[model samples]
Target: MNMATNTPLTDEQSTEAAIQRAGKTAPRVTLMDIEAVVTSEFYFTASDGVFGASNYRPISDRSGVALGLLTFCVLVLRNGFTVTGESACASPENFDAQIGCDIARKNAREKVWALEGYLLKQRLHVVE
Candidate 1:
């Protein structure tokens, strides 16, 4: 009589195989990179909108825009927004400070779509 048997690989061996496979493949762009691009574009847009057509007190507008950008960045970063990326809208805490929760939610939804479009046009893919 002949019997077929299966043997399981050790964890160390499986890990080593995964590492080797990873090393041989081209580095893939991650969702984090897409998030960074979105963040940059958001700030750039805000800055340009504030200063692009201003002649009087351009400095004041620039300063206000900068402060707003920094506040947004700090809020997002400190609150673990990057980990959720475009899904931050689903969290109530994200808009807890806003005067109108409904408006905040709507804006967040729009932002996700806009950011996704920007990333797609830039040839960036979000890793699942």
Candidate 2:
């Protein structure tokens, strides 16, 4: 006939009671609310790779470094060649006849030079 003896509140109930008491006595932020705010502004976008919208396109498949160097040259000579700022290095079609072939050849030469330097260093550091 005694409800208290029949079913006593478990530790969880005691914990909840303590929490409610603390809530009433003090103003405090919960950990869960802090976590929610921390995670709210997080994001993921598909354009995170090297060839993202921020980078140049028509990039060389052989070497990304070479492509980046070529893109730099394209940007530098763009104004003189009448290629617009927005179109610089982003679109090959924007490259004027004077700059297109020269840019491509320069990029290829840069790649070759880099490879040669790497090979020279390797040879210099041979164990024997």
Candidate 3:
């Protein structure tokens, strides 16, 4: 904690904390493990091409190009399974491709955790 601000120090504010918490309950999934399962990753936008791009790009005085700023990530895993994730920006001024990709990747990785967790549980006979 920082005495000056009376706030907890967030030096270790990361996914590792969540992984540690999961360990307390049963078998757990780590981010690295999740990442290992991903064989390929593709990132795109609503206006990337052909389909959605044909429609009007919505706009607003405050958000500018916000409506068309939806970002998506499609992750192909080792076993031929695929998962998708998405991120959206409320304000175009704050939109960033890298940030969107990071968020979308994290979102997709979360689904892998769920899937892999279930598979592990089943293999361990922890659930019926």
Top lDDT hit: 3
In model 1, the worst 10-residue window by lDDT is 70-79
Please, what are the lDDT tens digits per residue for candidate 1 over residues 1-128?
Answer: 11233566544346546767778554433334434544322222233444555633333564653423321221132224431212123333443324333343334434554655565656645553
Q: Which stretches of candidate 1 lie above 4 Å from their native place?
A: 1-99, 124-128
Selected candidate, larger lDDT, 1 vs 3: 3
TM, every model:
0.22, 0.26, 0.68
Residue runs of model 2 more than 4 Å from their true location after superposition: 1-94
The alpha-carbon RMSD values of the candidates against the true structure, listed in the order shown, are 16.1, 25.5, 6.0
Cα lDDT of candidate 2 equals 0.39
For model 3, name the residue pairs that clash.
Answer: none
> Distance from true position, residue 128, model 3, in Å?
10
Q: What shift in Å separates residue 35 of candidate 1 from its native position after superposition?
A: 13
lDDT, candidate 3, at 12: 33
Residue-pair clashes per candidate, as listed? Answer: 0, 0, 0
Candidate lDDT scores, in order, read 0.39, 0.39, 0.76
Q: What TM-score does candidate 3 get on C-alpha atoms? A: 0.68
